[model samples]
Target: MQKDEQRNIILAIVLSLAILLGFNFLTAPSEEELAAQRAAFEAEQAQLAEDANSGDPSTPQLDSTLSAIENAAAGLTAPLDRSEALDQTPRIAIRTPKLEGSISLRGGRIDDLTLSTFFETIQTDSPNITLLSPVGSLAPYYAEFGWISSDSSIAVPDSKTVWSSTVDTLTPSQPVTLFWENGSGLRFEREISVDENFLFSVKQRVINNGSSATELAPYSLISRTGTPELLGFYILHEGPIGVLDNSLVEVDYDDLQDEKLIQNRTTGGWLGITDQYWLTALIPDQEQSVQTRFVYTGKGNTTRYQTDYFYDPVAVSAGETVTFDSNVFLGAKEVTLIDDYQEELNITDFDLAVDFGWFYYITKPMFFALHWITGVVGNVGVAILILTLAIKIPLFPLANKSYASMAKMRKLTPKMTALRERFGDDKQKLNQEMMNLYRQEKVNPAAGCLPILIQIPIFFSLYKVLFVTLEMRQAPFFGWIQDLSAPDPTSIINGFGLLPWDVPELGILGFINLGVWPILMGLSMFLQQRLNPQPTDPVQAKVFMLMPFFFTFLLATFPAGLVIYWTWNNLLSIIQQALIMKKAGVPLGRQPDEA
Candidate 1:
C-alpha cells in the first residue's frame, strides 16, 4: 500500500509537469502560423511598393518636391542611409545636456535625435542610442507640428515646404523660431524650446492677413517607419500608448496593423509610440478638445506607424493671429522625471508610459525607495540589500511568530515520527492522531507557510521594478556583475569564467548554465529550509528537501538583481529563524528522526 501511494505521488508530479509543458507547447505559435505571418509581412511589403509607385491618393508623403507632394503623401520614393537622408535636407542643430541631433528644416520636424547619455552597449565607446531618424532614412521616426486647413484653396505648411529658422542651433536657454509664408496672405511661425531633460515645448502661431476668414486646425504627429523590434515579453508594453479620458490605452503593433486605426477625442491627454525603455509622445493643449489617433499605414517599401492629434478647427479672421500650445516628450523613461512631468505639465497618467505593471501602487513606491537608496549609496546592488532589510523590519512581528511556531513543530518531530510508526498502516488514524497532537501541543503546522505567502507579492513587485524600470538597466554591482537587469554572466559551465571557453547556447535547457549567484541563492534557501519543520512522510520529506535545488534551476534565468535579492532575503530569514528557535529553546542543529 505504501509503495502504491508513493507511485501515485510520483505520477502526480510527472503529470503536473507534463500539463505545464503541454500548455506552453499548445500556446506557442506554430510553424504554420509563423509562415503565415511571414507571408502576410511580404504581401504588405509588396502592396506598399505598389502603392508608392502608383501614387495612392491616401498616402501622406513627406518629400519637398511638388510632384511628390501632389502624388505620394508619406515619404521619399526610395530609402536612404541615415547620413545620406540627413544631408539631403537642411537642418538646425540641436544640442542639449542629454540629447544631440538635428531638426529637419525641410519639414520643420524634430527628426534626427540620439540620447547622448545612453549607449547601445556598456562598452566605453559604444554608439549612443539613436532615438529618431530622418524621414528618408531606413527607419524614419520623427515628430512634426503644423496647421491643417479644410479649405482646398488655403495653403498650409506641408512636408514639402521648407521653413527658415531664426537661430542656427537650438539650445535649452535659447529657443528657435521657424517661419514660413503662403503666397496668399498667411504666415506660420513655430517657436521650439527644449528643457534640460526630454520635454520639448512647441508654440505654433498662425496669422491671417488675407481679406477672408479662414479656418485651420493645429496638428502634431509622431511617425515611425517600419515596426520596431520588441522584447516580446507580455509583462512589458511596447507600441502605441496613450491616456485618453483619464484611462490608459495600449495598442500592440500587430493589433494596430489589423485594426488600422484607433481614434479618441479627449479634452486633455497625450498620445505616442513607446519602445521598451524609450518614449516619444505628443501632449496637446490640456484644456482644448483634441482628436487623437493611433494609425498604422503601409506606404512604399516600408510601413509607418503614427500617433497624432488635431485640435478643433478655429476660424482665423483677417488680420488676426491665433496660437496653439503643446509639448513633445522624446527620450529615456526615467521614473522620477516622468512623475515630475506628470504633475508639472498636468499630463494625466503620463507616468503609465513606464509600464509599472499591475501592482503600480507597490511597484512605483518600491522603485522610488530603491532609487533613493541608489542615489545615496551610488550602487543599485547595495540599494537592493538595504531595501531588503527595510522590508524585513515592518514584517518582523509576523515572521517572529511564524518562526516560533516552526520551532515548536521541530521539537515535536520525534513525537510525530512515533505517531507515524504506530499508525503507519492506518492513514486515517494517523491524520487524526496528528491533529490531536497538534491541538495538545498548541502548535499550528501551517504557520510556517505564512512567511512564504507574504513574500509572493513582494517578490513579483520587485521583479517588475527590476525588469521594466530604466533606472535598473545596466546597473553595476561588484565582482563581474556589470548589469543587474541581465542574468548572471558567471556560469558554472565555464567555472564562472575561470576557464576561457563558454557554454554553447541551450534553447530550452538554459538553466543548465547555472550561475554563481543562483548557486548561492540555492544554498541560502537550503539553510533557511533546515530551520523549518520537516514533513513526517518519507516521500514528502525527500521532495521538500529537493525544493531548493529545483528553485535554483527555475530562477537561474531571472535577472541577477532578483537573484541577489532572493539570496539576501533567504539569509535574513535564516538568521531570524535561528534567533527565534534559540528563544523558543529549540536546538538549531536538531534533525527529524525518520527512523
Candidate 2:
C-alpha cells in the first residue's frame, strides 16, 4: 500500500510538469503584442514614403510620362495581327526553342523584337537575348526586354536570329550603331551605348524626310494567345511599385477548379508566380521613374487589371531624339541573392517575427539584428541554441520561483493523502479539511501552476516566429536540413515508396513523405518524461507516457525548425527540473512528501 501511494505522488508531479511545459510552449504572444506589430509596420511604411519623396528627381518626369502613355493607349486601335482576328486560325504562336541564356546590358529598355524569349537572365557572360515560353511540357509565356516600343501596333517580328557566344565578345557597355532605310524614304539611324553590364540605351533619331508631321503613334505592347491550360499561371507587373490584381488564377489539373491570386497592396514589392517558376522586380533608374500595373488573363478570354501610379508618360518630338531609360530584374527566387539585390533596389520589407507579445517585439528586433550574425555562425541550428540560452537566462528568477512553489506543494502531499483516506467518499468534508490544512501550512495549491501558465504563450509565440516568417524559408540549419521551411530529410518506409500505415492518401497524410525526425522527437520526449516525477495511478501514468507518442505522430510533417524548438524546449525542462530537485534537498529515489 505504501509503494502504491508513493507511485501516485510521483505520477502527479510528473503530470503537473508535462502540462506546464505544453502550455508554455503554446502561449508566447498576447493580443497587445499583435497590435504593436501592426502599428510598427504602418510607421515604417510612412517613413519610407517620406524619404522617397524628399529631394526626389523622378516625380516630375514620372507624372508627365504616365499621362502620355495613358493618352496614347486610349487613342490606339487594335492591330491587324493574325491572333486578333476572330475568323483567322491561330497562326501566330510564340515559340521558345531555348529557355536559358543571358542578355547584354545593365539597366535600359530594349526593343522586345530584339530578344528570342521574354524570360532571360542578365549576365556579363553569354550576353544574348533569351526568352521564357512553354515549348516542351511547361506552361505560360512571358518575355523580358532589352528594348520595348511605345507603339503597341508594331508587332514583334518573327525571325530566326542566331544569337550565339560570338555576340558575347561585345562589351556590354560599348555602343552599337544601326541604320535602316525603308522604301518610304524614311531613314532611321541611331547610336546606342551598350553598357558592359549587358543593358542598352538608345536615342532614336527618326528623320521623316517625306514632308508633313508624321502622325504615327509609337508604343510597345507584349501580346499572348493560347489555351488557358497551356499557360499554367501568368502575372504581368508594370513597375517595381505596383499592386497585383486579385483576379489572377492558378490552373489546377486535378480539380479543374482555378485557384485565386492573393493580392497585397502596400509599398513597392516584387511579383511572384508559383506555377511559372519565375519572379520579376522592376529596377528603375533615376533618369526614368517607373510605376507598375498587374494584369491577369484567365480562362474564357477573361482579363483583370490593377494599376499603380509611379511616373508620368513621356513624349518624343518628331525629328528629335527623346530618351527613356529603366532597369529590369529577371531571375528565380533565390532568397539570399534576392535580398542582396533588394537592398540595392530600395526594398525594405522582409518578414521575420519572433513572438507575439513584449517578448515578440523584443525578439523581432533581435532576429533582424542577428540575421547577418546568425548567417555567419555557420549553422542556423547553432544560432537558435544561442538565442534560446540568451532568453532563458534572463527569465531564470521567475523560473526558479515557480519551481520552489512546486517543491513546497510536494512537501504537503502526504498530509493531503492522509486527509483523503480519513474522509474517504465524504467529498465535502474532505475538501473542507484539506483547505484548512493548506491554510494552516500557508500553502497555495495553485502556485505550482502559475509559472507554467505564464510560459505557455511564450513557447507558442516562438513556434509562430520560426514557422510562418519568410526569413527562415530557405535558411540552412545543420547537415541535411537544407531548408528550415521543409521537413527534416529522413524517411522510414523507403525504396518501395509505399504509404505508411495504409492510411487514406488525403490532406495531411498525403503530404508527409519524411517521418524520421518525428520519431526521434518522440523518443526524446519519452526520455525526458521518464527522468521527471512519475504518476502513482496506473491510468495517469499511461496517459503521461502516451502523450510523447501522440506528439510525435502530430509533428511528423511539421517544419524542421518547429521540431528543433520543441526538442530543445523539452531538454531544457529536464535540466530545470533536475536542478530544482537538487536544490530542494530531495533525493533522486525518495518521495518528496516523506522528506
Candidate 3:
C-alpha cells in the first residue's frame, strides 16, 4: 500500500508537468518578439505620416535649414542606410581600445561610434553593435557640444558650421582640437579627449581676440531622430534619464512626446537617452548649475528625442579665453565600468544608467554580487549560482525559524484534526479553540510563507539584472544555454533534435520550449515541495502539489540561465528545508509513524 501511494504521487506530479508543458505550447509572446511587432506597426505609421504630410505643414524645425533637411529627408535627414549617410559626412577618425567611430567635422558631432567589444550576435565574426549614427542615418543619434550665447550676434556654432581640425584621428592619448572662427573675430576651439573606455572630455574655449566681451553658456545635446521602438515594458525604463541635484530622474520617450517637453533647472546632473543595453548621455560640469530638458519634437514623419543641458552664462572679455569642460558617455552599460566612472570621475549616479527598476537597492547589490563572483569563477552562469547562495545566507536565520514553526505545526496536526471532529458544526467555537491551540503551541501556520515571499524580490531583481544589462547579454552557460540573456533554444517537442520534426515558434508560449534545464528545474521544485508534509485540505494540497509543475513549464521559455538558477535555488531550498525539518523533528509524512 505504501509503495502504491508513493507511485500514485509520483504519477500525479508527472501528469501535472505534462499538462503544464502542453499549456506552455499556448503561451504568450516574449518582449523581443513583441518589440518586432511594434516595429512593424511603427513602420506602417511612418508610411502613413509620409503620405499625410506629402504637402502639409505644421512640422516645426530648429531653423529654416532644419525645415529644408526634414522636407528633403529623401536625400538628407532620412536615409535608408546608415553607412551611406556616414560616408557623405566629413569625419575625423576616433579610435580607442574599446570604441571606434568618427566625429563629424561638419557639425563637430560625435555621431559615428561602434563598441569594439560588443557584437550583434554570439558569432565572433558578427558586426559590432553600432552606438551612435550620423544625422541622416536610419535612427539619427549623436551628441554635440556648442555655445548657447545670450547674445545672438556672436555666431555660435550651428549644424552647418564646418570646423577645421589639425589631427586626423582622436585617440586615448592624443586629443583632437577642432577650431572654427566667426568672421566677427571670436574664435571657438574644442579640444576633445577620450579615455580607454567611453568617456569623452570636451573642453570648449572661446577667445574674444577681435572685439568686445560676449556672454556665452556652454550647451550639450544628445538627439535621436525617429522614436526607436522601445521594449515598452513598464518595469524596464528605456529613454531619457538623469541625476539632477542628487535626485534621480527618468522619463519615457512617448511620455515626453505626449507631454511635449520636461524641463528642470538644477545645480548639476547627467542626462541622456538610454536603450535596453546601449546609452548616450551628456554629462555636464559636475559642479555647475544648469537647466536640463527631456524634449521631443515631432514634425511630419520625423520625431526627435533630445536630452540637452545648458550651463549658466559665462562672460568672455576681449582678449580673454573662457573654457568649459564636460564629458559625454556613449557605450554599453557595463556595471563595473559605469560604477568605476561614477566613483573615479565623481559623476553622480552614473551606474543608474542601467535600469534597476523600483527595487534598485536589491537589484544593484545583487548585480554586484553576481559581478564579483563572475570575476572569480570566470563563468557568468556559475557566478549567478554563487550569487544565489550569497543572497540566501542573509535570510538563513529567518527561514530556519519559519521552518521550525512549520515543523511544530506538523506535530500538532493530529490534535487539530481531533479538535475539528469534536467541534463538528460549531464554527465560532472551533475557531476560538484553534486560536487557543495555536497560541499554546506557539505555532504560526503562516510563518513558512514569509520566506517564500522574500524570494520574490530577489528573483525579480535577478530578472532585472539579466534583462537590462549588456554585461550578461551573450553570457554563456553549460550545454544548450549559450546566452544568459536569451531564451533556451532547445525544445522537447523536436526530441531535442533527435527527431527531424520541427517545433513551431510558440511566441509567448515559450514554456513549450521544454529545455533540459527546465526539466531539472521541475524535478528540483518537486523534491523541495516533498520536504514538507502535504496540506490536509484537499484544495490547498492540490494547488500546492501543482505549483512546481506549473512554474517549471511557465519558466521553461525564460532565459536559460534564470531557469538554471531557479533549479539550483529549488535544490538548495529542498536541502535547507530538509535539514530544518530533521533538526525540528518534524514528521516527514502527514501521519506520524506507526510501529
Candidate 4:
C-alpha cells in the first residue's frame, strides 16, 4: 500500500509536469509571431501614453499659469541625455565621503547626484547609482527650494532664475550659499549644508528692503518626470508616501493618477517619493503648519510626480529678514542612519520610510537581531543561521509540547483504525467514536497545529525584512548566492551552471526552473513531513505529500536569504521532531496505515 501511494504521488507530479511542458511548447511563438507581438505591444504602450497625456474630462485642470510653472519646473520639454542636461546648467560640485554629484545653480535644484558607495550592478566597473538627475534628462528627478508670493508683481526665484553661489564646491565642512536678487529690493539667500551622510539642510532667507512690506511663503518640492518601474508588490509601497498629521499616507502611482491631487495640512511632517531602496523627502519646520500636496501631471510620453509643502505665508516688515528652515533627504534608506536622523532631527515617524510593513513590531526586531548578529559574525548568511537558532531556542518549550502531542496521536492510530472499522459505512458514528477516543486518551488532534500557527507571523515578518530592508540588498551568501535579496541565479534547466546555455524565459511558467537551494528546501520539507502523522483520508494525504513540491516552485522567486532560512528551519524542525517522537516511543518512519 505504501509503495502504491508513493507511486501514485510520483505519477501525479509527472503528469502535471508533462501537461505544463506540452502546453508551453504548443503555445510557444515563432520568430515572425514574436516580432508581430512586439510591434503590437509597442503600439499599445504608445496609445496608453497618448491617453495619459490627453487630459481626462472629469479631472480638474490647473490654470494656464500654474500649468506653465509646473511644466517648466519639471523641465517637461523634449528629453535629453543626462550628460547633456547636466552640461546645459552651471553646477556646484558636491563632494562628500558617500556622495559624488553636483547641484544645479540655474534652478538651485539638488540634481545630478550619485551614490559613491553603490553601483548599478555587482560588476566591478559598473557606474555608480544615480539618485538625482537634472531636467531635460530622460527621467528628471530633483529637489527644488524657493519662495512663492500671492502678489503677482513680486518676483521670486524660480526654475529659470540663476543664482550666484558663494563656493564652487559643497562639502561637509564647506556649505554653499546661493544669492538671488529679484531686482526689486528683495534679496533671496539659500544656505545649503550637508553632513557626511544623506541629510541636507536648506535655510531659505529673504530680506525685505523695499519701501513696502511683503508677505512670502516658502515652498519646497521633490519632482520626478516619467513613471518609474515599480516592484509592484503589495507588501512594499514604492511611490508617493508621507507622514501627515502624525499619520502615514501611502499613495500608489496609479492611485494618484485617478485621484489627480491629494492635499493635506500638517505640522512638522515629511513628504516624499520612495523606491525600494532609496528615498527623497522634504522635511518642513516642525513648529509651523504647512499645506502638503501630492500631484500628478502627464504630457506626451512624460509624466510628473511631485510631493511639496507650502509653508504659511510670513509677513516680512521693511528692513526685516525672515528665514525658513527645512531639510531634504536624498539617498539610500539606511535603517540605522534613518533612525538616527529621526531621533536627532526630530522628524516624525521617519523610520516608516523603510516600509517595515504591517508587522513592523516583529519585523523591526528581527532585522535588528539579524543586523547585530551579522555585525558580530561578519557574514549576513551566518547571521541568519544564528538568528534562526536563537528564535528556535525561545520557542523550544511550545514546539516540544506540540511535537509530543503529535507523537501521542500517531501512537493512537491503531485504536482510531479499529473505531473506523467498527463504525463502517457510518460517518456520524465514526466521528463520535473518534471524539470519545480523543477524550479518553486526553490527546488533542488539533494540538499539532499550534507550532504551525505560531510560525505564520514569524514567517511573514522575516519575509518582510528580507523584501523591504536595504541592508539585505546585494548582500552575499556563500557560493553563487551573491545577492541575498534577489532570486537564486542558478537553475536546474541549465544543470545548475553545468551547461553553458541559459534558461529560456517562459513567461508565467518561468518558476518551473528550480534552483539548487529551493530543491534542497523542498527535500528537507518532505523529510520533515515523514516524521509527522499522515492524514487518514487518501485525498488529503496526497495533497499533503504534494505540498513540498508546490512550495519549491512557489518560493523559487523569493529572496535567496528567505529560501535559506526556510530550508535551515525545516532541517531543524526535523531534528527536533525526530528526537521528540523517539522519546515518546512513537515509530518514526512507519505510517499508521502501513503499520
Instruction: Compare the candidates by lDDT and give the number of the best one.
Output: 1
| Candidate 2: worst-modelled 10 consecutive residues by lDDT | 53-62
Q: Is candidate 1 or candidate 3 better by TM-score?
A: 1
Q: Over 4 Å off in model 1, which ranges?
A: 1-78, 299-301, 590-592
> Once superposed on the true structure, which residue ranges of model 4 sit more than 4 Å away at CA?
1-70, 73-78
User: What is the alpha-carbon RMSD of candidate 3 to the true structure?
Assistant: 6.1
> How far is each candidate from the true structure, as Cα RMSD in Å?
4.9, 13.5, 6.1, 6.2
- Candidate 1: give the clashing pairs: 60-73, 60-74, 61-73, 61-74
When summed lDDT is taken over every stretch of 10 residues in candidate 4, the lowest stretch is 53-62
The global C-alpha lDDT for each of the candidates, from Candidate 1 onward, is 0.81, 0.41, 0.75, 0.79
Q: 1-595, model 4: which lDDT tens digit per residue?
A: 2223234434544554453343234333444555655664465445433443222111111233232333433333445568877898899999999999999998798988899998877888999999998766656688989888777799888878899999999999999999999988999999999999998999999998888899888888888766775544556788999999999999998798787778898997799999999999999988899988888876544466888887877899889999999999999999999999999989999999999987789999999999999899888888898898899998999899878877887788777767767886887777777777777877766666666666666767777888788888888999999988877888999999999999777555666778999999899989987887765666767776887888788667667898899899888999999999989899889774833
TM-score of 4: 0.88
Please identify model 3 stretches exceeding 4 Å from their true place. Answer: 1-80, 150-152, 432-442, 501-503, 580-595
Leading candidate by TM-score: 1
Report the C-alpha lDDT of model 1 over 343-365, residue by residue, as the tens digit.
99999899999998888999999
> Model 3, range 224-311, lDDT digits (tens) per residue?
7767765555567778889887888888766887977677877656989888898898888888888777777666555666788777
lDDT of 2: 0.41
Which regions of candidate 2 are displaced past 4 Å?
A: 1-100, 103-137, 141-278, 283-292, 299-312, 319-321, 332-344, 348-374, 419-485, 491-507, 510-516, 530-543, 587-595
